[model samples]
Every structure is written in structure tokens, then in C-alpha cells.
Target: MDTSGFLEWLKASLSSSEKTSDRRILRFVHPDDDKRFLRSLRAERPGSKPLRGIRRLGIIRAYSCPVPPEGLPVSFGGAIVWEEDIRVSTHAILAAQRVPADSGIPWGVRRIRAPEAWSRTTGHRVRVGVIDTGVDFDHPDLRHSLERGINLLQRTALPHDDNGHGTHIAGTIAAANRMQGMIGVAPRSAIYPIKAFDYNGTAYVSDIILGIDWCVRNRMDVVNMSFGMSTRSKSLLNAVSNAYRSGVLIVASSGNDGKRGRIDYPAKYPQTVAVGAINRKGEIASFTNRSDSVDIYAPGERVDSCWLRGNRKTMSGTSMATSHVTGAVALLLAHKPGLTPEQVKTVLKRSKRPLRNAKAPRKTGELDIARMLQVADKLM
Candidate 1:
């Protein structure tokens, strides 16, 4: 059917139904045609309210709008494409008991040998964007590491932690409290929390795309995505590719499905560095999604980090592993400020410590930050 006929049918269908419809994101084939198309859509239904929450995803040349069901056309003569705003969740699985804080560095931090390379570069001045739940801004351990961040959920509000997931990830990346609390891999690095996810640890695909766009525009050296979705979104992939081309290194979790040869989106995408989880015994975590696409593994089992109300918690997931790698990337960037994502990945790959368990065939080696720096030196 023609575009106008399709729009009329959609409106009639929606008017006949008693249920409310969910919002869908729309992408224009040519970004220049966006206004013309929107004008046409508005012209069809005169005096109707315009689309709300119209977020311009400049990187992907798309718009995330809450268009009413009646206003949404299935296809707009190939000028625009639309997709459901799919949900994405954090990869963290909280342990039953909260672990007491240890004044020294966490085992995961030590395992990666983050401290060994501190004398050379502790990720000084590197900017790492964390796209997840908001952070605990008042947490003492994270005070020095945080910068003013954006809250996509609430534009006027500071990106504060309603859920502890982001704080945990932030602490692992750059918690700088040295005397009474633990130090992270990149203690001097700056963390810019992008609150895309909510207190429920869930966010829509549009929100994540906005977060990635923010990262690219803000010139973040590295971005840590500790969450994943099972299905692929072309919109998300486009944003990732744009960010990668803009010199942003994205580190993402493989997933927690415990399935062999299957990983999650964003990580599964070629532009991102896909990471899986490992335990203290240096074996792959059974819960971690295994696949040949996984670029590396890191200590993820029972990791301790900052939580809400200035507390500490131990959580487990590939999310934790991705944070470790993010911090390590920050360290690399601090030492060699202009290394491309490809170069950074090569250094990590070259310096990885071989896993003891050969049974896990697809798993790559664990992170070795000290060795990574040595490898970087040789490239100079």
C-alpha cells in the first residue's frame, strides 16, 4: 500500500484498539529529510500533538520519539525505518551476602596487576565514560574519580546512584581512596557516569544509543558498557561504529547466559572489545557466555566495589570483568595518549596471561596490566 494509505490504516487500527501502544524509534534514510518527513506526518493529522521526547541520535541519523500509536506509520516510502525500543539490563548478579570492606586493593584489581604499573601510569587524566545506572556521587572512595555526568533519565538531575550497579563498576575502574579504602586499576582516571539505565537496572535501546552519542561528542577515551541484550539492534550497532570511528574504545561484557558460542549484542558487534569473566582460580566462570568473539577475560567472580550509602558489595558477572578491562584501557591511554582502538586491543591481546584450563576452548587469556604496559613500551 501507499504511505498515506498505510498511515490511515495504522490510525484506524489504533483507534479501534483499547490498549496503549509502546514507543518506537525511527531512523531517517537521509538525515536531511527528517524535517520534511515529520512535517508530512504532522500534516496528515492536523491539530494533533507532535512527537514527544524526540531525541536526535546524530551519530546514527535517527530520532527516538514517543509518537502516538495512530501517528506511527509502518513504512514511510523508504524514507524512514522504525524499531521497537527494546529493553536492556545490567549483567550483575548480586551475591546474597555483602562482603566487608578490605582496606587493601581488591583481589580482582591485584589479579590484573594494576598496582604494579602504577609507578609508570595510573591512568592520569584519561576520561572513561561509564554508561549504566547512575553512580553514588557522595561515596568517599569515588569522589576523586568522578566528573559531572549527564542523566538521560532526568535531564535536570545529577546522575546519582539509585541502583548500586554503576557505582560498583565506577569503583572498579577508578576509585582513588587510598588510605582507608581500595584503589582501582586507574586510580587517577576520570569517570563520567552516563545514566541511561534506571533504578531497576533496565533501559531502552534509545537511551543507550543516546549515551553512546554523548560519549562520542564528549571525546571519552574509553567507554565501559557492563550490560547487554540478547537481540541485535541495527541502531545500536551504527552508534557503536560511529563511536569507534570517533576514537572511543568500547569495552562490553560477553554476557551471562552461560551458553557456549553465544554472546550478547554491542559486545558481539565487531567495534567493541568483548570480555568474559574468570574466577580467582583463573578458570572461566561457568555463568559467563563463551564464544570465539570474546577478546579477553578478567577477574569477575565475587568482586568487591563501592555501593550505595558509602557501603561495599560483592557482585559477580561479565559486567565486573568488562570494568576491569575498561580501567586497563584507561591506563594504556594515559601512558600512550593517542593509541588507536586497534593498537590498544593488540597490546591487551599480546600481554594476556594464558588461562590454565584448556578445557574452555573459546576463552581468551586473562588481563595482565603490568605486562600490557611492557608491551606498550616495545611499540614506542
Candidate 2:
């Protein structure tokens, strides 16, 4: 049967059941079947009302619907209904202390030796997509670094920071108000903030998948994902894989569960460059998820960056650490645009500085931008 037939059958099968109001259904169709799939959704059956709140994510060739809670096959007519899950921001708000404009660069940026690599490339022309809460466009440090971004929650609105997490993350990646405020690792890089999460820093897995789709379609060079969830979602994995295959480097947080060997989804996925956190003393953070899956570490403790309402706040987590790595990746991509995600990860791993304390510290270490750039230079 065609896609519309399958959708019609599925709708009929679910509508006959009693519990159809509480659950959401995400249908994944191949790109070639998108038009037919959407047409089926638009066509009204004789007795049923049109499907409401249908979200179409064309980049991923998927659409989400509200369905009943009943046993349904995983796949139908070449479409897969993904399991529903929630993803949260991986950072912890330490405090809301404001810093002086002359506070200089944040310690995290300086510790990574980003300044040393500035002479060669300061992430000029690199587009970094931040899939998080949104950004504070009015923030002085980030005013000029932001590019037009999409709001998945409200399609017609701009992706403005409401939770402050994206603003901080963006500041770490490319804030450039050097004189009026602090500088980020890649001050010249443009940030495209994709607001998938709400003010509470929570987002559905489908929204995140849509965010990654936006990144790939928009030609973002690097994607900074600071949120994570323990449960694995195949749809999320497929989205990450698709973005990586499209030559977009994905940098994600290793989660802040303090678990020794467990990393979060998307980060746990091998296609992404997973990052962990370190403190000022260069020791592995107590809250960071440490494991072989973690590709590298960076300063994440008590880190300061731009916040909502044009302010600065101190936060901590693998999310902050991930931002540092995201900026570093932007710097590398700025210098060498053709570098693949694997090549970028390899260079980052090779240039890591040894951790002051951790088991098997040599296996993975902190990011060293100066050394990373040097390693990239050797490839030229």
C-alpha cells in the first residue's frame, strides 16, 4: 500500500482504541516518500478529523503526531515511529555572579590555549550551530556573533534565549565583545542558535532530531549539543549519523550524572565527538561522566559566560566543557574547512594535555588549542 494508505490504516487502528490522547507518534519516512506521506496526512478520512499538531521535519524526512497508547508495530509502509524521550541540559547553574567587562577571557578559553591559535585563525567565517535553549541576542558579548536561527517551538519567531543556557554556550563558542566584555574561544565565528529546548531546558527527542536536521540543511560547520539523555533513541542516532555524513561535526556533552562508565545518548553515539569536564586544577570533575566514550575534557567548573537579559552568569557541567570543544572545533574548521569530523576528532585527541588526576588519564586528556592547531598545521 502507499504511504497515505498506511497512515490511514494506522490512524484507524489507533482511533478505535481507548487511550489515544496521551501519547505522541513520530513517523519517519524516507526523503523520497515525504511528499506522499505529507499528502496522506493532509487528506481527511470520511469520519475522522484532520491530524492536529502535526510537526513536519523535512530535513529528517519525519513528522510527529499525537497517538493513542496501544501496541503498534514499530514500522509500517517504510516509516518508523520512534520512541518518545526527553533530553535535558547537562549543566548546573553554580551562581549568577556578574563579572566586569574587563574580566578578560574566561578561564576556560585561556586554559585551552585558544589565544595562542588566534594568530593563525580565530574562527572567522565558521558557522557553528548551537542546538540548545536559544540565545540572548541583546547580550553585548554575543550581539554581533549571532546569525539568524530557527525556533522549533514557534516557527515564525527568532531563537531567543529564555533559559540562559544557550546564551552561555554561545558565549563560550564565539562571543566577540572584547572591549565591552570578555572574548570567547572563536570570537569571529557566527553562531546559529537553534532553540529546541524550552525555558526549563527540556526538549523532546524529536525536537532535537529536528534541530540536527536544521543544522545540516543550513550548512552549519559545527554543531554544539549541550544536552543529553540516558535512554538511547534510534531516531536521534540516525539524525546524528545523517549530520556527520553531511560533513557537519557534532560536539556533545558526556552528561553530568557523575557515573563512571555511562555516557548520554547522542554523546554516547560514536558519530559525535563526546566531551567531559575538568576543573581549574586540571582534575577530572566529580560530576562528569567519565568513560572510554568520552573523547576529551575541558574546563567546565564555575565557568562564566553570557546569560539572559544581557548579563553574565557562572555555570558548570559537561555542557560548558562541550562548548569549549565546540569553539575549538570551530577554530580548526576555520583554518581547514575540508577537514572531516573524524580527522578533526583525531587532531583534537592527539593534541590533548594530560589530566592532573584521573584513571587512565593518558587515554584522553584536556583540549589544548595551541597544540591542536599545530597538529592541523602538520597536515597542511
Candidate 3:
């Protein structure tokens, strides 16, 4: 629901006078101006509005602030890294902390074969709710993954995918993208979208709780939550616990704060599976939150997956990796039908792709679906 007010402001400034351009950018603006700017933009154009009179200058991938900008910057001044525009600055890192662990590099998602799961059960019939930003249901890879999503911004039950993060998470879970071989853990699984995070990836704790309840009432077999906050509320934990009792497999992302050894809540809650990130080297991502609370690690860095507006983006975070586990559980459940949640966790623990076990760094281990299927065979 928020528009690029910074860009809009810049457009206004540029149009106001090619002469007043000498004025300091972002100066004289309050630190909370971004919020006000967005509110104003919303008051003007509600939805699906094209930024008129603004130049379609490529993009600023990341604008690292030399001083962290206090909070969110009030102005768009400073060196920005545009897709086509090159600037100089050693301190300005990308706004995103995502680092590429893998490129377009092909790797197996590790699926159950016909013996354990049916050949026809591509998870197509099952619906998994992804409570994040809305998904681009039309994305070739995510079209099959999407069913219908909610736009909390518009307060509507329609599909709205402004941010590409949700689409990435959805694809990792079940991107049957035209069957382009870009399969998720459960490519056949359908996705019931939920937009908790806004376009800027900002969401509230209550929104998350409400989203979980919605999933529970909808009888979603699995709920993939790839976002987290530092707070630990009994209400949120109770919601997860209740959802678990409702037979919902809750999977959450360990926050990528990179402070080390701290597990973000929701993921740390017993009701959910805490997932970490692994780079293309098959080594743990240094930025991934590490601790015994972490249940499993999966590919998260530089993951090339579905995006909004018919595009593909390679991003990194435990958020994307958690979807792998969610889809894997769906596949195992569809195949084994009788496996309990504990049994599912056991299979994941025992069949890991084996790391240099130095003190069992995490609660479980690295996820290896291939090994999990083998473990399931023995359990049967």
C-alpha cells in the first residue's frame, strides 16, 4: 500500500525546478519522514498506481549508510547503488544483507520417489499458507504454487505481490513454474497466500498471530513463515502451540541478525522448526543465526528463485531455507500419511547431509531430504 515516497519526492524536486537541485537532499526532513511520506503517497494514490512523471531509472540494489542512518533515513540523499548507475563508496553496503551462496547453480531439491510418495502426488492438491508478503500467483514458477492470498494493505482477500520476497519463499516451497524443472520441496503443493509483511518487509507481531490463526482455521497442513521479530510473547508462542495441536506444521526462519548464538522467537518456539542457512559451498552461512535452538540448516544464500513482475532474483536468508523443510514435510506427510510430527522431525534429524559434528552445534543437523526418505523407509 506504500509507494516509493523517496523517489516520488525526488521526482517532485526534480520537476519543481532544475535550479533548486542545489538544495541539500534529505536535510530539513524529520527522521520519521519516510513514514509520513508513505502516508501522504497512500492518501494520494491508493493502489496499482504507476509513479507518473518519475523517470524509470534502473534501481538502487543496496544503499549502505556510512553510519547506519540512525534509523530509516528521512531523506534519499547519499550514495546509492543503482543497477545501471555506478557510484563510489567502500562503506555503503547494500540495504540487503543477502550474499550469494549459490548462483543459477542447479542443485537437487531432494524429493520423495514413487516408493515413499506417489508419482502423481506432486503436492498439487495440498494448499500451504505462506504468511508473508503476497505472492505473484501469475509467476510462471509460482503460479502453480499460488492459490489466493490476502492483501492486508488493502484489507482485501485478493492476491497482492508488491514485494518479491513472498514469491521467492513460495517458489522454494512449490514453484512448479511451468514445470520448468525449478521445483520446490513440494512442487505440487498449493499456496494460500497471506501478506503480513508490507512492500518494505515491515510487519507487525499481531499480523503474524492473526495470519497463523487464519491458517489454523483453514486447515492448512503446513504454514511457511520466513520472517521473525526479536520479541518473545506468550501470545505468539501460544498461537504456535495451538496451531501445532491443530495439526499444522509450523516452520519459521531464524532471524539473520548475524549477532551469533541468538535464536529469534517464533522459530525458537518449540511449536515451529528453526531453520538456518547454508551457502553453495555446503558450508554454514556466517550470517545465519547459529545456536542449539536451530533445528536444521538449508540452502539460503544466493538462492535464485521466483520474483514479482515476471523476474527471478537470487537472495539469501534463513527465510528461503525454511520453505525447503516445510515442503519436505508436506511431501513426507503426503507419502507416509501416518507419520507423526515427532517422526517427521526424527527423519530430518537422522538423515541430515552430515556436517563436521563439532559439538552438535545445532539441535538437529543439516537437512538432507534424500537421507530423510531413507530413514522413513526404515521406519515403515
Candidate 4:
């Protein structure tokens, strides 16, 4: 409900001119209110017109109007709240980290104990929705696990990765067949690419909400969001809440700001599993964000996975760590498809491997996917 960020930005932009000419964007309480408010604003302030808008769990509407210079338009009375729509990529430096062990599998794969997990379910029945830029549906390592997708930016059915970030995240979650020298934690899980970010890896909160809405409508088992923003958004929280209520497990990156302060939105929201990064040494990554909201740590430093153009590359970030946990969730869900979001969290917390040097209990250790599967089997 914090509309302060949006209001502050509007005030600064309006200060440049006595009467601003640009459209002011806002999230309304309802669709009917958005229509009625825009009609009233135009009637009272002439020349004001409604611009682009989208309605999901919340109503997002924008309008072009002349500022009064004295105060905000009366039409904005209760329809106004802080719009925390601006979100940035949580990816850290993109360089390869050398692995000491010569295990044929990627170090991250080994770090999460994924090979042992393969003996059980390989995540065959789970569907993970990657709400990032998009995925490379043709990449050899990911193509087999890739399923249908929707592009929110272009309003299309195919959501392809142009930024390469989404492909990396997707590959980490469900790469299959050891193709192109890579294997994901949940190799057999289906990945549904929900393209919310653009080529620059930038996404708005509204776009993310739309993507989550799509996932809920499609009944996706889990959603992986490897991005973060500093602000708390109402619409984003509403979308996440609705998704969780609908039985979808959500995972997100704590952030890569390297700060000990609060983590990012949606992840900070209690319903999400906020993940931080650990390096090859099993120590917290130097760039990983720390906070109570972070639920677990995973291998993220210099991790290699599928990339654009059927190639592979090493990247580091809580984004990569988030993908590992997403795959782990798929593995658990494949065995126990009826588990609720709270049940999934409990299993993950119960099966976590303790880290000797972890700063706190929250970042105590990495995910033990094999152990998680064993626990799931016992529960069944």
C-alpha cells in the first residue's frame, strides 16, 4: 500500500514544469474505479486522458493530465497508492568459477546432491514456471524440458529469451540429458517460460503480476523469480498471495546487492522462499544479500548452465541460487504433488544441510535435494 515511491517520482517530474504534460501511472483499487476515476479526471481537468492499463489481482492505470501545481488532482482521492513496479535483475558478475573437483557434473549440480535425487523422481510430474526474460526453447540442454510459454511484453504465445539471463535460470532448474555438458537438478521437470522482462533484463511489477496470474490460471506447480526490487509493491504482494493460495510454490532470489539490509520484494513477502548464494567453498557468496527473510543458501558462484544460442556459460548471483531451490521444489512436488506451499517449506527447512560457518540459522546451509526426496518418500 506504499504509494510514496510513485508519488515522490511524480512530484520530482512535475517540479520541472508548472503543469506537467506526461501521464501519471497508478494502481487503482478496482477496474470500475479506474474507469470512473479517469472519466472524472478528464471532465474536471480537461485534456486528461487514460493511457495503457492492465487489470489482474489489482488494477494498474495510467493517465495524461495537466498538473494543478498546488496539489494532486481530486480524482486521485483514494485510487492512489505507491506503485512499486520497478524491478531490476539480481544477477551478479557473469564469470566462470573454477571447480576443484573433476566430477563430470557441474559443481552446482553436485553441491545440491542432485545425482542421488535422479534415482527417485527426476521431477517428472512437476511444472516450473520461470518468470524471467524467457527461455531458449531450442537450447539442447533445455529444449527437452521446455514447454509452452507466454510473452507479456508482446502479448504472444511464445516467450523466447533474448537477454540470455532467463535461459541460464531455466537451465539451472531443469536442463536434461547431460546435453551440451550440463545437467540441472530436476532434469525431467517441464519449464514454462513466462516472459515478463525485456531484452535488458528489466521488468515492471505489473508485468510480473501478469506473469504470476498466468501461472495461477495454468496451474503451475512452482514459480521461479530470479530478480528483485528494493521496494514493497501492493500489486506484487497480491499476486504472490493469490498464487500461493492457489497451491503454487514461489521461489525468489534474496538479492545481489551484497548488503545486510532488507531483501527484495515478493521474496521479502513471507509467502515466498527467499534464497541466498553460496560459493565453491560452501561459504556465503561475497555478493549475496543477508536477511532473516532468506530461507536457504545454494551454490551460485561461477555456476555454469545453458545459455543463448545452444551454448553454455558460467554466471553468479542469488538468481542462480534461486533456480537451484526451484528445481529442488520440483523434485519434492513430483513425489508429493498434493503438498501445500507450507508443507513444501517445512520439508525444505527440515532437510537443509547445516553449514559450519554460516552467519545465522537462516543461511545455515545449502539445499540437500537428495535428502529432500528421501523425506518426501517417507511422508508419502
Compose the digit string of candidate 4's lDDT tens values, residues 60-140. 244322234344555455655434346556465664643222223678889888888787778996889999989888887
Instruction: Please provide, for model 1 over 217-308, each residue's C-alpha lDDT reduced to its tens digit, 9 standing for 90 to 100.
Output: 99999999999999999999989998888899899999898989899998999899999999999999989998888999999999999999
Report the lDDT tens digits of candidate 2 across residue range 269-359: 9999999999999999989988999999999999989988878888899999999999999999999888998899889988888888746
TM-score attained by model 2: 0.91
Residue 248 in candidate 3, Cα distance off native in Å: 0.4
Off by over 4 Å in 1: 1-19, 35-50, 67-77
Q: Please give the TM-score that candidate 4 achieves against the real structure.
A: 0.82
In order, what lDDT does every prediction score?
A: 0.87, 0.84, 0.62, 0.76
Decide which is better by lDDT, 1 or 4: 1
| Model 3 alpha-carbon drift over 4 Å, by segment | 1-121, 178-181, 356-363
Query: Lowest summed lDDT over 10 consecutive residues: which window, candidate 1?
Result: 45-54
TM-scores of all predicted structures: 0.91, 0.91, 0.68, 0.82
How far residue 285's Cα lies from its native spot in candidate 4, in Å, is 0.9
Error of 4 at 117 (Å): 1.3
lDDT of 2: 0.84
